[model samples]
Target: MTGAGGNPAPSLPGRFGPSFDVRTVVVEPGGSRVYDEAEWRGAIVLLERGRIELVCSDGGRRAFGRGDVLWLEGLPVRALHNPGREPAVLLAISRRPARR
Candidate 1:
C-alpha cells in the first residue's frame, strides 16, 4: 500500500499491487528465527527496529540496521538473529498466493 500522497505500490505479475500482504516480525534480544528457504521466497523486508543479522548456510553473516530494505528471495540465509540488546522488528511484504 502507498503512503499518504506517496507513489503507488509497484505492479505485480499474477496480481495487483494491493494484493500483497505484510507481516510484522519481532526478534527478541539474542533470539533467532530459522529462515525456511521457501517461506521467504519473493519476500521484501524492511528493518524497523534495532539490528539484525542474516546467518548464511555457509557460516557467513550479514548485518542490517533500521531503515534497511531487504530482498530475501533466492538467498541462502539459515536464520535471522537479533544481535542487539533490544528487540528488533521488521515488516515482511510478500505477494499473497493465488487461491484455487
Candidate 2:
C-alpha cells in the first residue's frame, strides 16, 4: 500500500518462523539506523516516541511519529532517520508462523 506521499508502505520481510520476539530501540536526533534485508524478514515495528523517516531502496521516504506501526514484510528499508530534535523510540515485534 502506498502512503499519503505515494511511497509504498513498509511490509514484513518474510514469513515469521517459529518464535516471537520484541525489542526496544532508541535513536538520537539526526541519528540513523540501517537493517539488512536478510534480517527482520517478518517483523513489526511500532514508533513509541519522536519522529522518524523511513527510507526505502526505491528512493521512497515516509515520516512516522509516535503511535505509528509498521509491518516489515516486503518493504526494502535502507535506513531510518530521526528527524526531530528529540530522541526516537521504537518497539520491534516479530512472531513466528503457526505450525501447519
Over the stretch 16-69, how does candidate 1's per-residue lDDT look in tens digits? 256778666777889998987676677788786789999999999999999899
**Candidate 1 minimal-lDDT segment of 10 residues:** 7-16
RMSD of each: 7.6, 10.6
Candidate 2 residues 1-100, lDDT tens each? 3322353333432233347655556677898888565555576788867899988888888999998998766677888899899878776777756779
Q: How accurate is candidate 1 locally (lDDT)?
A: 0.77
* Candidate 2 C-alpha RMSD relative to the actual structure: 10.6
Q: TM-score for each prediction?
A: 0.73, 0.66
Query: Model 2: runs farther than 4 Å from truth?
Result: 1-20, 96-100
Best by lDDT: 1
RMSD in Å for model 1: 7.6
